[model samples]
Every structure is written in structure tokens, then in C-alpha cells.
Target: MLAKRINGALRHVPAWPLYIVAVVPPVWLLWQGLTGGLGVEPIKALEHELGELALQLLIAGLCITPLRRFAGVNLLRYRRAVGLIAFFYVVLHLLVWLVLDVQILSQIWADIIKRPYITVGMAAFVLLIPLAATSNNASIRKLGGKRWRQLHKLVYAAALLGGVHFLMLVKGFQIEPLIYLAIIVGLLALRLPLATGARQRA
Candidate 1:
């Protein structure tokens, strides 16, 4: 089968390369900012790009299970790396916003309280902290497989809030953020057992 062939090819592909490749983007973005490539508002552009990349990674992570179950394309091996990189991007985005954009701690706190999108984004970031902290064999053994799976389910909520945060932050009827939110909702819907059962037929 094609999936078997793909899986075989993927077997030789190590996860470590993913980490190395993922590092390139942020480094490139930083270089761009320094070189006047990210435009006048370099910090804001950096933050926005990182946040969007994080959202895209979240979407890709959500697709992994569905792809394996429905299409027989097993990428379970790289899921952890993808998830960790996504969390890293999320942290980078927050740092750009906090350290570069809003240096004042009090103002940052006030913005988190006053801006609905920032609140939602911050909530998503909070949800990701534990997941990022425990993305390893040690944490899996410490928490056990079942409990760890339960804890990681928080990714769904984080992903949803990320989409919503994007939608809320953009003014007017922006199609891009709307598409992101719709894709997130659709991916979440695919996780329902009923959806699986229906796909399997009556």
C-alpha cells in the first residue's frame, strides 16, 4: 500500500531533524527583523508571524491522528517534536509581544485584562505550558500513558482558543482568520467518536 511505502520512507527519517528545521524559521525571522526585511514595525511583524506559525503547527498537530486513522499515514513518531516546536513558537510570540512590544509589566497586565484577543491568546499559552513541560519519555512514565493522554487533550482547547484569538484580533471580516477558526472547528469535529462511527457506517 502507499501508506506502507510512506511509512517505510518515514522510518528512516529521524525526529531530531524536525527540531533543527524548526529552529531555522525563528532564526530566519529574527535575521529578517534585524535586516529591515520585516517592515517598519519589525517587533509586531515578528510577533504576528510567530503566532501564526504556532497556529499552523497546532493545526498540523491536530491533523496527525486523523491522518493516521483515516488515511493510514502514520506520523505518530514526529507528533511530539511538532507539538514541542509549536509550543516553542507560542512562547516566542508571547515574548515578542511582552518584551519587545509592551515592555511595561503593568501595561502588559492591563492589556491582557482589557484586550479580549490578548486574554484568549494568553489562556491558550497557559494551556500549553504543562504540555510543553512534559513532552518526553520521563513525563510519560511519571504520569502513565492514560493520564498523560488525558492531560494532552488540553491541546484541543488551546488550538481552538488560538484560532479564536486570531479571529478576534483582526479587525473587520477577515477571511484568513475565519478560515483558521473554521478549520480548527472541523478538525475538532473529526475527533468525535460519532464522526468515526459514521465514517465506518451503520
Candidate 2:
């Protein structure tokens, strides 16, 4: 009943408002970073925050389908905005690493090639490119729904890579990264049709 009410209310809500609100956090983070509020390692702090936000948004976007299917909470209207915001943060995170953390072009390329985490992160970002680019009605009409969905399925790969990247980037046995990895794995598992098949067989 509560889900129905929320879903009904959401139908009237515009996605543009969400986009406007979403821009605030990154702007605030940038201000804080510039004003020395991020402490001694401001660049690293800013990069970590942006990367984490991106991952969280990606996870939230992934949750939409599951929420509608399992809990009857429809949020299809905002999924595009959530995905675009996730990509925006991802781009910002990459920029901060490239411009602030590793200013040298050769060193940046070397890190991407030499570091495993950086390699995975770069791969995830690359996968997001097509999805972000084609997120429009015109692209949908041009490519057709089936092809568009297939292309967007790359999101699962990107999400998995993102989880691994986060896990590997943190030093030692950190519980936070492990938790994020576990959440990503759980969400992916929920999307599998195996459970339904097994239940039917039983």
C-alpha cells in the first residue's frame, strides 16, 4: 500500500528537479576542497568522495528494476537521471585523479597501464561511455528498443568492475569496500533468472 502511494506520487514528479538537486553535492564538495575543508590530503579526499558517490548512484540506479519487480515500487522515471548523474560523478572522479593527483601525462598513462585498480576503473569508465551517450529518445528510436537494451546491459559489467576497483583501491582489509562489493554482488544475483528456474523446478 505504501509502495503504491509512493509510486503514484512519483509519477507526478519531474526528473529535472532531481538533476538540479544532484548537482549541488559535487559543487559543495568542490567548494570545500578549494577552501581547505578537506584536510591535508584534499585532492585524495575529493577524489575518493566523488568516486564513492558515483558508485552509490550506480548502485541506486541498479536498484530501480529490482525495486519495481520485487517490491512494486516503480521509479522508472528517474532511472535515466540517476544513471546520468552517476556518469557525471565518474567523469569528475577521473578528472580529479588525472588533473590533481597525477598532473603528468606520462605518469597518468603509466598508472593506468601499471596499476590494476586504475586499469579496472578505466575499463569501467570506457564501458559507461556508450550508455551515457545513447541515453535519449532519439537514440532509442534510432537503435530500436532491443538493441538499446542490449547495449545498456554493459552496465552490469561496469558495475562489477567498479566494485572490484573500489575494493582494490582501498589498502588492507577495509570493511567498507568489502561491504560495497557484497552489495554489488547481491544486486547482480537478484537479477539472475536462476532462482525462478530453480523454484519452478522444485
Candidate 3:
């Protein structure tokens, strides 16, 4: 029964073309920016693009469980890649701020300490580093499944921090950040003890 279940899940997941779908948006954004068609402030455009990518990846990471359980696609295999992409764009977003806006390490550090948004964003990025580093089959085997799962739970917190950072960075409340916050909330809700307990008994 277990073997058949796993096979059924595998059969439901679409082919590898789905990976390309994930890569296309960033590529198109870069192409648009390079062609001088993004917007008046290209740096701002780049920053927003990278930030959006980070948020999208966070949402995609959260969707894995629902896709697996609801659609029976077992999309957990893509979660690590989605998480690493989140970290990658987060690094780019930080670099844009450091290089284009702040221009000095001392100033950047000062802003992180003084500005709540910067602090939260920095905290999220910092948490992502270890998760990204250890996101591999080999690392999972080394850490054992239980410890690995516990450590990776930090993603939920990191996603929250990312949402808060974006919310505070905006001049006022906006739809984009609100959407991200809602998605994060929903995803985290799905991971609550109640749902997990049900899954365990299933």
C-alpha cells in the first residue's frame, strides 16, 4: 500500500519542465532591465525584482506540502531548490542596497541597528545562510531526518521576517506586501500542530 501510494504521488507530479517555469521570470526581468525598459530607476527596478523573487520563492516553498497532499504530486523534492533561490535573491537584494544605496559597511551596519526594517531583513537573510548551506541530501543524511526537519523549520520564521521587512520598507501599507504576509500566514497555518497531527495519523 505504501509503495503504491508513493508511486501514485510520483505519477501525479508533472515532468521536469516545471523547473524552467520557475527560472523564466527572473531571466525575463534581467533581460528587461538590461534592455533599458524596466523603469526610470533601474536600480530600484532591480531591487524590487529581486525582492519579489525572494518572496515568490518563499511562497513556493510553503506550497510544497499542499501540492503534495492535495494534488498528490509530492513536490517536496523541489523545496530545497526553491529555498536556495530565495536566499540567492535575498543576497542580491542586500547587495543592491549595500552597493547602490548605503555604499559603506559602517553605514549599512548602522542602518541595520537603527532601522527596524533593515534589522528584520538582515535577520532573515542571516537565518537563511545556514539553511541554504545544509540544504542537500547529504546534509540531511548527516543530520538525520528529525534534526534536519527541526532546523529547517526556521524557514517559517525567516518568511515572516521577510514579510515584515517588506511591509515596513514601504512608505505605507500596500497590496504587494500584504499579499506576501497573507500567503506566509496561510502557509505557516498549514504547518501547525493540528494539521501535522492529522497527517501523521493519515
TM-score of each: 0.96, 0.95, 0.84
2 against 3, candidate with superior TM-score: 2
Query: Which of the two candidates, 1 or 3, achieves a greater TM-score against the reference?
Result: 1
The lowest-lDDT stretch of 10 consecutive residues in candidate 3 is 11-20
Query: Whose lDDT is higher: candidate 1's or candidate 2's?
Result: 1
lDDT of 3 by residue, 1-202 (tens): 5645875767656544555675776677778877887886777888888887898888888898766665555767667778887887888788888897678888888998999988999999999898999988899999998899889989889999999888888885579888889889988887777766675632
lDDT of 2 at 142: 100
lDDT of each residue in 67-130, candidate 2, tens digit only: 8877899998899999999999999999999999999999999999999999999999999999
TM-score (C-alpha) between model 3 and the true structure: 0.84
lDDT against true structure, model 2: 0.92
Root-mean-square deviation of candidate 3: 3.8
* Tens digit per residue, CA lDDT, model 1, 39-78: 9889989999999999999999999988888899999999
Model 1 deviation from the true structure expressed as Cα RMSD, one decimal place: 2.3
